[model samples]
Target: MDWRPWLTRWSEEWIGCTAPDELDPDVVRDGWLGFAPASPEAVAAAEERLGTGLPPSYREFLLTTDGWRDAGCFVSRMSDTSTLDWVRDLEPYWQDWEEPDDEEGDAEGGPISRGLLISLEADAGILFLDPGDVDESGEWAAYSLFSWLAEPPTRFPSFIALMESLYAEFHEMRRPEGATRDSWEAQVEEARRHALAGDIDAAEPVLAKAEDFGLSRATVLRAQILLLIGRTYEAEQLLGRLLHPSFTPDGFFADPLFAEEFLPLLFAEHARSSSPGHNSILQSALIGDPPELQLIIAEHQARLRRGAARATYGNPEFDDLVHAALERHATDPDALWRAVGEALPRWRPRSTDHIAPVALLTHPVLADTLTPERGRALLSQPRGDHR
Candidate 1:
């Protein structure tokens, strides 16, 4: 899609919404958000100098505006044709840092050593386009490398896609509702409130949208929603992205809902799958936990070896309940699950936040109870009203 109109709109909205202190003095004085378009000769010179043709979206961007201000919250300026150069030439030291192997679908090293640097000023990050990985439409893969991000550089399909994501991040931070893109933070809060109240159906879509806007917590919330609807595999896949050997149950992880509900669901999935790919995730995650948690993992592993393994929710009380339910040996697991679901709300946590433990609604035992119609009814009901 042509980004000129949207870019112009984004610039205007940014100029209108940004505070005077944050706006560049020149921008405020001139009431202009971008530089004059680059001449064909200038564009040709950069392409010839770099020995690779510039991608269409970026080339079109230069034709629209040779340079741009506030490309994102951190990028103070975008390179004009005159200033654009290869990342290797501009920052050769980038090649010295060892590139990690690709995890999941994340690209290795982000091609930083072989990319076209697009941004002129990056306060804490750099934006580059990888000409080596082009799509059918000839748009190069774009990357946003941030200093604080522990993982590989965030990749986009094209320059336009990268710019759109940056713009979305801008909207997420500024919350300029009714100005450009919808406010992702607002959507996240709305989804959180709904999910906590046991309205997963209502919350799921908003959470999904917030996830698209780079809200990490939204992924967690959406995973819970997926679990509530009995989509255990999908939920497991989503949570897998967030899980790492070094994951700490601190900060947001310490939240009562996340600690009590989400973690258990993830651990349960790990035990059930025991796939070779994720075997190490469980091993690394359990290291340095409380002695009780360690014992649980050890016992679970022993049971797995004996071919008599059972899923545990990672909480002692809940595990006891699960053991009791299994001991009953009722012919119908669904009936047993329904009983467990009914008791979930009363399962108190170690934390003070008495926000209804909706996370328990995702227990593997209760999956059978979350049939489409029943799941919708269960999730739509207010907290404490689940049958």
Candidate 2:
């Protein structure tokens, strides 16, 4: 198939504009994101060195753009025609299963031969053509090898077919829906870096700019910033809008920004809230803490089930103790109770002891496991009285 025109159009449409000097070795020697067509002489030299004619589509691709950067997957710049020495460089590493295996004394069984065609440095993998696995047109079968997997190589029909598959996958990752300008994406990335570094002051301004452009990701980041600064009410309100059914109707929960960043903040804020009603807001919104935290809470409730437990509950420092107790008491209920008993001696006489523990007991996981009688009994325990 005439792949040159198609490749050119794809490059222009997806890869964006290219300068005339982009193809110059000096220009792209450091790095580049697109392609530069090679001379016919250069292609001929590579073919002569490999002793196999390049696949028709790949050959045409080179005629249009000699090598590309990140064509698909983690593939770096394809080897320019002049630097086609990877074939020779990788010969020693190739296992010739055609011959008998001297170590195992087995002629038929051993590591199979893999003809390496392209090496992807960042991905730690290679694209190869297997002579033994050819197609009707005499094109070699293409395969991919990765150092991370012990299984057999993944196979494809031809180089062009492999490229096509990679392109499709790359497009999916770009999230073409509601596409934004490259500049907008860059601004969002910069904002995220600031947010991650705990510099909300710096991040908010940049995110505001991206939000002005209607970038949904920027909204998510802003929600994260709000949560970080202890603005749970505002964060949840914004998230409700950004993640509303009408706004992100299709993949609201599945968006990585939501799942990885926003959701965790929501769960943590719920965990930290002093008001049972405020904490319940998350449950009413159908948001739950992660399973690990839920499991820890369940175990804590089990200990509370055993007997009366003591904890200092009326101060800000007690919040830290509540978080710590939830994590520390799985098998050693005695230690947890002892820690709480130790804190009680320092508790002020008028301080409310029931609030934090009662709040915890009312968590959905715990509340569901305990009968109403049992829950009320645990809530009535007078362990916090110093007398």
Candidate 3:
């Protein structure tokens, strides 16, 4: 379908785009935006809808605000365990979202399940999303995203205000009596009040209610608030769900903007001295990683064969580790080989997928250890690890 032209009409009529000068509009004929970058509003909405509170970071993300972040599908349609847990608790209302259709229906439908993530692109340099999925009014959502992309706002205040204004209007028209919408506005007010009074606890209740109002982007703001207050686990959980690779485009990852914002703390918060677990996974990400470091390692390795991210593994930030790994591997082939093998488990490493082929091809024991035989063998199975 002519998504661009269609988006133009939709944006003007639904999102209050009176003229082209008010917004930029376009058609994403090719390329993509990293999926599921994370939305503070969505997280908050999800929580309030379920009558539960998300982790402090997630909630704080909602309370906090920003303009543009990474958008588009960077992860697969799969849900991380944490997301699965939250969704298990919220499966009812999300029922409206399309499930992973075993039969890929039309170009417009996009991925199978909902709960998508907004991730970062290694090279595309723009955020993207299914014009149909995220937009409340499919055509309007598409149009609004187009307009924003055409003329990306320079400031967070403008971005937040613009979306808030649009969503507020969208909700009023679509769900006038829905307590969910009313609760969302109330929560925003509540969060504002709590912040003013310095009673963060008081803010929690309203933030909780706001999320119920279908304002998932609030999670982004709330996560910021939680981080400011040092509630890392909850923040991790919310961000984890927000950036999990499973929610993005087929080959996309997490949002670079989100990574830039959280990486400093992410390392200190989740890294383990040793072993490939959650923390490692989150920390090792050159760009898009989950909440923990080890899990980062595990997930990156799982995605090694993706040609698009060939240089991800040996990111400049990670060169030291690679150098160290190279040195250690050179000195102790056995130990190094063991680590390489360890990297091969279920998930792929970001380094291996995007690192220069020469660098990876040069690893003396890489071919021997991460052999196609073994790599294929390990990944060939019908694993439910990420998906």
Please identify model 1 stretches exceeding 4 Å from their true place: 29-31, 98-110, 181-206, 211-224, 227-332, 337-387
Q: How many collisions between residues are there in candidate 1?
A: 0
Writing each residue's lDDT as its tens digit, candidate 3 over 196-294 gives 333555555566445433354455445544543445457567655545544222222353323323443344344333265534425434345344544
lDDT of 2 by residue, 285-347 (tens): 445444533453455447658864543233446445644655686345555544544443333
Q: Give the best candidate by lDDT.
A: 1
Q: Candidate 1 residues 1-387, lDDT tens each?
A: 675678777777787889888888877776667878888889999999888888888998898889899876888898899889888788766554326442224443447777888888888678889887899999999998877775567889999889888887776556454533446667776777776577776788887767655566677667756765667667666665555322222354545555456655555656666766646445555555655446655654576589873444434665567557656734566766665555455454344322233454445445544575555554554543222
Candidate 1: C-alpha lDDT: 0.67
Cα lDDT for residue 387, model 2? Answer: 31
TM-score for all models, in order of appearance: 0.58, 0.39, 0.25
What is each predicted model's overall lDDT from 0 to 1? 0.67, 0.52, 0.37
Off by over 4 Å in 2: 8-34, 85-88, 94-114, 177-387
Task: Write the candidate numbers in order of decreasing lDDT.
Answer: 1, 2, 3
Model 2 Cα displacement at 84 (Å)? 2.2
> Model 2 Cα displacement at 164 (Å)?
1.1
lDDT value, candidate 3, whole model? 0.37
